[model samples]
Target: MGTHQLTTINNSDTFEDSICDLFNHLESTFTYKRFGKNGHNQKGIDVFSTEKDCAIQCKKKDLSRKDLLIKKEIFNDIEKDVNKVINDDLKVKIDKLIFVSTYKDHPEIDEFCEILKEELNTDFEIIYWGWDTLESKFLANKELLNKYWSNFIIKTDSKETHFKRNLDLKKKIAKDFGNWLNDSQANRKLRSRILLRAFDGTQYPDENEPDEFGQYSWFRAEIKSLYHKGMEFIIGIDEIQVFEDYTWDFTSNDNEPKGELVNVAKVGQINFSDIIDYDIDGDEYYMFPHVFCKFIHKGTPFENIYYYNLDKTYEYFEIKDKRK
Candidate 1:
């Protein structure tokens, strides 16, 4: 959801009324009464709720252009409201006083509230709800925002909601180069340097060990096939140390090889439009949109792309004869 500014609402009265309405649903027992603009001017409170024992004062200032002059105006208003509540009979009924404004919350308000509370020797809780607080509540109950304060949100749908559009873009790229990628494999194989995470408990290769393709050789590579893109034998280096410590250098400029020689496996090409999420450690992430596109452009799949395959080492699987 986009950020909703309270000042952008039609009028200050409407903004104040909508706030009372929000509390009506949030607290079922709360009885909200508005007495601000319609001939009956509220003493200080714009809205008051009996069940919640609270009073709200709403202000819709030009929050975008905040200066010392504007801030002094807000402070003066607060001082006037506090003075009114101090002498009023309703002060005894409500314990919580909330000041709602479209402006960004400042630390000075907290200091001001503490000073007022101490000077008056009152147990009443005084607090200010700035743009941040109001925005959160508005987002939580979107129906209220849509009906009463629709103008706050300039765009109903934000860039975060464009997951479908992003996927479509990826698919279009694949389609544009699909035929060439398929046919080029037979005529000329595309070789790429891939870094694969090591299986758990895999021992790091000893410096004394010979550089060869074997389980004991401490260096291995695997070939992953992109179905739509075609069959290209990708050399995946399995790191000697645990996968966590190994930083993947996309340039492959580091002179040391990380993992042991592992078997090559064929994977079916993934459809970008309808790809399932990859769940790792209870976190869900869209796999195809992220990794496949990277492989198409950067030659590196998402981290832990081949972790499952790395777990079971295949001695018989070979890429020597298949390498072009």
Candidate 2:
């Protein structure tokens, strides 16, 4: 359900609250309820509401409402999966797939949107409630954003909780970083990119293979640590440079530079353990670099400053194979 007029009050709210509010606002306003056949929910289609008898799959953002950007393209993958499930269930043609978000600039969130437009072979209209989009479309509804400014909680993992607990025990973690980003224009400076990981020794959904649609793709990394011990998830980052005019294909997605921003470069060195507060001297590691392409140029530095998506591909992936 991605074609309805969605109006969100806030980007930040508790998980329970966001889900409840999303259901309530749309259902009450439109006289609709979730459509469940055989008392079953076909995943990804979180809120399937019917407005004027039309079905809408109200997909929520798989995010933490914290200081990180949600991975973008996965939403498109979700749409594919959801559509697959929907089509398999239906005998007649289906309706639209409406993806709702709070922020429009999120890489993972935005990337999938582009894919949706292409995959659906039509306008994958992703609606969001943010200052950037607000001024453009909802200057009249500015009061709504101002009134309900909050964030939704990203579901947590046991391992992530363990890691967080460890960090909490040592008081090594930053407190209220989310609040910091929420408070000012400072968040604009804190950008991140999205990366895919294969922990169970293989990529989930297998991006290189084609689906019934014959497209080799997968959804955004929403539920982290989906597989354990040998599983992995895609991650979003702020340092990767995404070129505006370029597309990321396996065979040379990086661009030939020109104009105001000539090239984009990563800062100092790559250190996986640096992000980990706990020790990792013995823990194994890997490397598979992803170059975030935006309107950036070469020589752009990363350090509380601008960065670039590194262009070169290793003999292997960025998050694996390096152990080097």
What are the RMSD figures for all models against the true structure? Answer: 16.8, 17.5
lDDT of 1 by residue, 167-284 (tens): 5555654564354334533343333222222221122322322212222212222234343423233344333222233322222346554534333343323333222222122113
What is the number of residue pairs that collide in model 2?
Answer: 50
**Residue runs of model 1 more than 4 Å from their true location after superposition:** 1-7, 36-41, 151-324
Q: Per-model C-alpha lDDT, please?
A: 0.52, 0.33
Give me candidate 2's TM-score against the actual structure: 0.29
Per-prediction count of colliding residue pairs?
Answer: 8, 50
Work out the TM-score per prediction: 0.45, 0.29
Best by lDDT: 1
Q: Candidate 1's error at 14, in angstroms?
A: 0.6
